[model samples]
Target: MSLRGPGGERSRWRWLRGLRARLALAISVILVAALGTAFVATYRGTGTQVRNQIDEDLRTDAQLVDSRLPLLRAKPGEIAEAAEEYLDERALFPLSARLFMVRIRGAGNISNLPDLSTAEGDPRLDRDVAGPRRESDESRALRTADLGFSTVRVNDEPLRLYFVQVTRGGRAVAEIGVGESAASVARAQSGVARTFLVAGTVTLLAAIALGFAFATRLSRPLRRMAGTAARVSAGDLSQRIGSTGPQDEVRVLADAFDRMLDRLENAFARQRGFVADASHELRTPLTVIRGQLEVLARQTDVTPDDVRHVDEVVRTEVVRMERLVEDLLLLARADEGELVRPAPLDLAPFVTELFDALTLTADRTFELSDVPPGRLLADEDRIAQVVRNLARNAVEHTGPGGLVRLTVRSLGQGRLEFALEDDGPGIPEEQRDRVFDRFHRTDTARARRTGGAGLGLAIARAIVEAHGGRIYADSSPEGGARVAFALPGFRAAGKRAAKEQAAKS
Candidate 1:
């Protein structure tokens, strides 16, 4: 879990689990498919088009040679020379374009250039072209003027040739063949294929590079978060991932982790502080008991007065220790957020009974001045505890001659305010906020003398809050301390009104 742990190593993957690897692979596949499709279409499409153009040119050139050749005036022997001169003038065929001509001299007699037989090139289309291509090209050309069209290789190179029989007035005066080389068509198509291959390869390489970079940028925060989690789980609650990336989903997750860490750190602080405070509070009473008992144990000539004083001192410490333990237990229960069973009660008489109880227990003047008619939904015991705690606080802080008053007033909307005001000096404004903190006491001398652990208001606050209410402190209208709290009221208006009207009757 530490930084030096194996968590830093990249986990193994099945081909594409890594974001970088998946992205690169996906990009490469998509690009290769698309470009490969385009390349195939271009190569085949261009090849077909070029071959078609070659065939058309062969047909056009054969027609031109047929109409322009002067076979009507040329004598039998002069026809070849005239046909060659005419072919050169029209430039219908390039040097690579081979020409073949045949003239019928007499019955069943055909003649052509003696050199066409000597012209050597494609082994297949060599001198044997006129001899062998004769049966196929001539017979077909005899029936149709521009019918001699065929694609064949000459000397292993592609060539296009056609045979044309020159005529005058529909009667054959001479026969000729014209052809053109088609090697350039194959070359052009091959060049296109090579270009596609090179382009596709370069594109795939570039896609790999870009895909890896994008995946890293996206997964970077997640990697960092995983590492942070490992460290945190290893007991490093202080570890935090600061907001470092753009305001994306990953950044949002990091922010949430930071908030959780803040809570964890605060919780740990409170736990440690609770332990330290408990130890300090318990040590004081234990030390007093130990010291008093030790002294009693050592004194052999102790009088009844000395023994009584020691016994009383030890007993007092034990009583205070018991009270401290009970308060701590209550706070612990409250901290656990335990729910209280709630029931309805009339507020006016509830205040009256607690007021009567306080009058019997304390010397201060106690009054239930104004008990407004209302009902509140609360745990009856817990509410009584809160009232008693506040009442005790008011009595303890004030002298014998000082006054204490308890009042409950309806605030409408299922709420009532209960307050205890004392004639003693009120809590300071700065200390008001922390007054309910556990073990916080302002009057150290009084705490030591009367054994008050300063948990009365804290416990009261806990009980009130658990009942879906709030408790706070402020100055009273009577110029003394006022500890007040609010609870949900369950007073029935109809019942109270009926009782009031009955009393009138």
Candidate 2:
């Protein structure tokens, strides 16, 4: 039961609810999903590739260490010197050494190498080579072990181990073993992971930004169309949305909507014109008929015994029908914007003349008050018709010995007001606005009894509005209904007089 638009009436809901936000969210979700999947795949692939490269490097380093061992063991007594010479001659080798060497005789005898202090280029290698574990069977086996190169955990630290066997005169003499820490391989893998992580983050942020921008661009035209439609629904047919391009659906929709509004505005304009024209055309006939009927009803032709009662009924019906036709004609002219306006006329004198001519019933008293010398530009005949109609309506509603008052005053700033007050039953608040509609009578039974066609107020309103005025019904101070009308004051007499002269011409 929600109301809509400026008038606060219930209306249909529109379709453009958070369209921009929904588009943005949908596009963002899609982009994020796509980017996330790609990032995960690329990151994993890169990590695997980097790890394979690191493993290859580790294996190559191990192989290089293994190839250099034969020459070192050729001179067992001078092994340290041989090792130093080989290390200096090798190219592109990433080998670091923690060495233990052992010598064995043909009869299964083992000899631990002495701390040959004079046999090395560096004293640290010489001292480490002369440690006591060089004589152990396990150390001897490791030196001769033909394991080319392998990664193994030693002392809870990953190490690359390479071993080479040495022999002299066809018998085993000594063996060489070398080991290097695997820390470099781990560092390289970590670098690859960091690079992939950074790349993934950047890709995700860029995707989100692009998604939002695209969504906004797409929804902007739709928003404009929605706004235009809202204005049209609120009775503003002049609004139109800008079209983007013919290739876009929203632009096509906007074009269609504008066309529809054009048709609607034209239809309403025609309807108003028809009503005004029909009302104006009928007024002359009704006036002629009413005048003829009045003349006939006043004739002092025959005796009361010879006069037919039907004649009285016919006169009454003619009056009622004339009033209805006059109301309809006025409404038609007002709707068609064809009502005439004449030169400025003084309101005080007009009100006095209208009251004097109305000839209220003997049972009711007609009173005038608050008369003002306000000048208004209008058609004299139409204004007189409105005043006369209001006065007659007041007389009909007033009770016996009741009061009917006509008031004309200045409402300041070039505005003149007219009010007809009657001491009769006041109209209900809810029915006040509709009282000016054709065929609308407050007391249906009484209207039927009095042969009223219920068109007096409607005609009065049309004449008032045709002169750029407004009329309404309200509560009177005398506990009855007050009907009021107002008109804009006079300007230069040229426009009004010209229009009146044109109508006459």
For candidate 1, lDDT tens digit of each residue in 1-505?
4854454454433435877898998999999899989988898898888878776776676666665556466654455455546645655544234544543343122223343332222344332244454454423332233436666654676656666556665666655555667777888889998898888888889989999999999888878888888998998888888868899998999999899999998999888887788888889899999999899889889899998999899898989899889888988999998846778876777778778888987788886666656567899888898888888878877889688988776556667788899888878777776888876777643444663667888898888889889899998887788999988755646766736634643
Write the residue-wise lDDT of candidate 2 on 1-505 in tens digits: 2333633432232222355546656766776677667656765676557545545654554456435545433554354444445555544454434333332222121212233222333433332343443344334333334545556654555555554455555755544445455645556556655765686567656765675677667777777778888888898877877576656776787788878888888888766664675555456446655665576678788556434554565565566566566566667677788877678776667767777776543467888874554467888898888877777777767767778888876555567778889888777799899888765666652444562455677778887877788999998998888999988865323555535533543
> Model 2: residues >4 Å from true position, as ranges?
1-307, 360-362, 443-451, 490-505
Candidate 1's TM-score reads 0.74
Which candidate has the highest lDDT of all? 1
Residue 346 of model 2: what lDDT?
A: 69
Clashes of each: 14, 10
Ten contiguous residues minimizing lDDT sum, candidate 1: 107-116
Q: Which stretches of candidate 1 lie over 4 Å from their true place?
A: 1-17, 65-186, 299-315, 443-451, 495-505
For residue 276, what is the lDDT in candidate 2?
A: 70
Q: Best candidate per TM-score, number?
A: 1
Q: For candidate 1, give the lDDT of residue 9.
A: 53
Report the Cα RMSD per candidate: 6.6, 17.1
